[model samples]
Target chain A: MSQKPEKLIDKKGLRLDGRKPEELRSIKIEVGILPNADGSAYIQQGKNKILAGVYGPREMHPKHLARPDRTVLRCRYHMAPFSVQERKSPAPSRRDIELSKVIRESLQPAIFLEYYPRTGIDIFVEILQADGGTRCASITAASLALADAGIPMRDLVVACAAGKVDDTIVLDLMDTEDKKGGADVPVALMPNLNAITLLQMDGILTFEEFEKAVNLALKGCRKIYTMQKEALKAKYESVKEVEE
Target chain B: MPTFFERRQLVTPGDLLAEGTYVTGENTYKENNKIYASRLGLVEYEDKKINVVALRAFYIPKLGDTVIGTIVEVGFSGWTLDISSPYLAILRASEVLSRPFRPQENDLAKVLDVGDLVIAKIMAYDRAHDPRLTVGEPGLGKITRGQVVKMTPTKIPRVIGRKGSMVSMIKQETGCHIILGQNGVILITGKSLKDEQLAMTALRKIECESHTSGLTDRISQMLKKEKAKQKEEIKNESKT
Candidate 1:
């Protein structure tokens, strides 16, 4: 693949973010962070701030399209007006709707929806700040929100993006790398089972390079899973002490 | 079993798990083979799944929650209230259980005009539909005088505490009759504006610092200090 000029200054093979090609960004996750929703979470990966709120498993589905066997996962991904350099419209545009659909699909396999047959789980993800890898961050945030809402899940979905930049594969691409680099690939993985729940790629890269990028993203997912586990544990411990 | 915090535990973002073994309908769960509990509430649990709910110290209105709102807008058959929710609540003409008084065409606003806050309850919710509200009680009309402050709805439960403990403490200290709106709006009617402002300030401080340990004791001490300071100022003024 023909790569763009290098934006990351590699010192001893380490990128500008002080991370090696195989290292992921620093991630933070919290569960039950929102007041109004059944479950909610806030996640921050470097400069990214994503808040995901989960409502439902409620019986109030659309009257016309009610299903009896499975719960519908309605996902909405929206960027706050102040999330990016340019202000986005408050209303969900076509791009937002498409992104929502993709996210909903990606999460469907992880949730045990049949447990709440005839109900629906609505996951709303709002990006307070967007640096890069928003889609993957949303996936991770939504999973936590769902779990916070106490929805059953086969496994937590961990997501992170990787790409080829400056003729080298990088894990967990930063905002600058995503814009100026080549062959960006975002992947969501069931880290416990090592299964890919979602995958997307843009830009140009050969099959061999793509495989390397995928491997890097999967490794990032595992790292993220550990962070997610710690967040939930801390929240619980704090509350338990209060009760005791 | 999760390890106990021998000292104060400072919780950060990356400390909790996204999913774990939760006993359904319980507010606590097990993550990494360790059991964890919720600080605020157990919202719901079902089938080995549990959800922890957070309590807000300030009041914010939710659909169908009963709240004391103020009539800020008077329309044809209803009045608009300044509930702390995102949407303003409306008390319809029919929902007003008053004596047989036919409201005149132009008298709608006259009966309940702007600048008047009321105490009404949210009767119905139209998530995509309009909110239907009601003021069917004696004290549900326009609020003539009071000061208002906003806080998160989730925080209201904490501020109220278990069976109104926190609110009663504030009321006894300030000698102010406080009306808490479900939508994070608080109305404080004191002997004067200064007193009202002081009460409001105290409430806001409490909301912001609710999660801190020894909150109730701290607030009580703060209130006592403020009272003593005010008493000293009055004494000095009298001597002068």
Candidate 2:
């Protein structure tokens, strides 16, 4: 890895990715990509590419793991060995495990798990490329896949990250900015309900900057909410086109 | 007193269908005086009630419905069957044979071995236990000499059409014995391989284009074209 320049933002207020201070990376989302899986999605956020597959509300194995009252949610977050600049090991790392747990918890609030008692829904997310904000992008793709699988839910989950770079608070940091940045905060929300599902912060930030960063991240999440809804609605609209 | 969206309006989960004095039906839940869609489906407003019809979903077994199942495991007294649902269906030896008792004397596997296909009826089911199946009913027993086609449960209704009209058309045209299962399994037996192949193509076409309009007309046209093409090929073969 190489060190970034001392100044992440220029006097013109543009970051290395040629983005404004509050600009997010380009996001692309597609649903129902994997025919075999009950539901699947592919997402691209700038240079980061992620694929998510969902199966279940089906039978749970090792019978004892089944929840008597509600459906159990299982999530696996993995980064491909060649995803990063350096070749990483294929084994699940501590960070991967932690991210998986957090992503599952973040999506739990949106699902109506009580509808499928004694069953389990499995979510698998693999990052084929990494820039930054992979966790947020993973959550976005997973939620779409869940909806694609026809699982009942209260709302879709949207996520975004904001960080302070070079003493300037910025939205949606890239890899270089994240490595050299200060106080990276990732936020997940249920946009329809205006509720936050996951909020985690690392590094240093002052009280005012923290508040600003959270507000910026929430705004980014709302923007993502629109994209997610469009992706889902597009699937049905295509059928309507044929009807006419 | 109730307001409803036009039929076939697409809705995603959690989307608000309406907010008023109205009765809610399947795939729609009411919360705080507002009705919300619970599935990715089409909205239907019926006689003062609102509901969303799911586009695709897993099959939920219901009592007294005949189903096609494959035996996966055999116990001392019953056989474990996979009905393509989340729960495993149980078929007892008594249900397999009309005669009573003597589980200790006869081997259950002999009657229906693992991997054998059977057409059975769901006798009972609830949240606590697996559904019980029975094969003693007429036309319900081991399924042999037919090709089975699996499809999405939601598309099953479209394939069957209203009052079995769609399916009967296919059977009449192709001369295949068609058994429709609510759980997305169809058994088709024809007089010859050509007849079976014709029916298969028609059914697959229906499944793929289940959401479109005027599908019955399209299917009938397709069947006619297929028959004509087959006759042309046969004439060419004779000339050669």
Candidate 3:
């Protein structure tokens, strides 16, 4: 909102990643990447690489933690010790736990819990690189992993972040923009019906500005949803062709 | 302009949605929706409420999953195997029914040495704790002097085929007792090293080309050709 930072040199209000205020980063996704996981995916959006592995919908839920009506969604979001610029601590710190909780809540709505009553679905999302918007990346990767697992889902959950930088709202904030941006708003959307499933914003923004940011983020989410659909369709089609 | 929820939704990496759309109450929301730019994705409106679907896969270890494992540590009760899953597997002492008459010091490593390649079954997986495994049964144990090949655990079911037809075909052709680990570690051993090498090559082909149909027939023809070649070489040697 004030003077632009040196890194955010805005000739026509575009970020260093060559994206406009409402443009998102390029995303590449591959499903069933992890052999051990029931469903898994590797996703790369710009420099952010994330691997999500899904396990369960299994019977046991730990007697004390069992739910009566639907299945439980347990998620763990972790960064590999070598994922960051510098090596992170080996053990999960408090920050990781909190992030995991948020991710779990975001993914729970997409899962069909009633289908597998009294069981639990465990999703482990690992950040292989931390450029920016790790949470959004994790959500996208987790959704693809779920689809690969053949679990019944209404639609895919696509996530992306939008923030204000240099007096303009930019979609898909890169690492530098995230740190220096005025306000950061990350969103996960069910792109098909145009619904909000997960939303988090930090820093300062007026109500109008916040709504605009959400709108821009949604636009980015739609772009990502197309890519997700294409990737899954391509994978299955390729296999099916081979079978034929 | 179309509203956010009305647009043909597209999902991008790292998009977040509103609070109530995906979760319930103050902080929770639904998972997957059909709505564009909505955090929960698209939705099919019914009965004034939306139904959300999961967009990720779920890992479930079944009764006879063939897994690739490494002997991480040896314990008095059993040997620990790191199968790259949430839970590690234990090959218990009792499961190893054929123990030496008088167990000498360091006998565990002798039979199943540290860092030995093993293809075992998921005898039982306890959600409360680690999974219990058994390599002592026929066709399961510490795999020494055999080549190990890796594949996706999901593809194991396809590779084995219906009612073990695929595996049986491979075995009859190669004359090897192949142990399929639920975790995708395949162990194949033949009477001689040459036979073992041939089997390993064939199995690797299967792993890579599993998506293709009629694999059984293709592999059967390949093996028959190999067998005839071997017979011709043997005949030439006898004439010499």
Model 3 Cα lDDT, one tens digit per residue, A162-218: 988877888898878888879999999876446688999988998988999999898
Candidate 2 residue A89 Cα shift, in angstroms, is: 2.2
Taken over the whole model, the C-alpha lDDT of each candidate is: 0.71, 0.88, 0.70
lDDT of 1 by residue, A29-107 (tens): 8887788887789999989999999887664457445366667778889989999887889799897898898788888
After superposition on all CA atoms, what RMSD does each candidate show versus the true structure? 8.0, 2.2, 9.6
Task: Report the lDDT tens digits of candidate 1 across residue range B1-240.
Answer: 223322234322122323444342323334456444333332433344444444322232345566766666777667777664434567877676365546663467666677666767777864443356777765565577888777756567667877998889988898898987776677899997767877887898776655556667778788889988988999999999
Q: On a 0 to 100 scale, what is the lDDT of residue A162 in model 2?
A: 94
Model 3's chain B yields a TM-score of: 0.61
Candidate 2 residue-wise lDDT, A1-244, digit = tens: 6866868888898999799999989999998999988988899999999999999988898789998888999999999999999998989999999999999999999998887788889999999999989999999999999989988888788899998999999998888899888879999998766789999998899999999999999999999888888887777677667757
TM-score of each: 0.62, 0.94, 0.60
* Fnat (0 to 1) per candidate: 0.00, 0.51, 0.09
Off by over 4 Å in 3: A1-20, A29-135, A138-157, A164-170, A174-182, A190-197, A232-244, B1-72, B81-86, B91-126, B129-145, B181-185, B221-240
Chain A, candidate 2, TM-score of 0.97
Q: Each model: TM-score of chain B?
A: 0.74, 0.93, 0.61
Model 3 residue B77 CA deviation (Å) reads: 4.0
Q: How many backbone collisions does model 1 have?
A: 32
lDDT of 2 at B104: 80
C-alpha lDDT (0 to 100) for residue A161 of candidate 2: 95
lDDT of 3 by residue, B1-240 (tens): 112232223222223333233323211134444222222222223333432222222234567665668888877656888775534678876677555433444456655657877777788864444677777556666566777776655457656888999888888887887877766667777887767777777776676566555888887788788888988998999999
lDDT at A74, model 2: 97
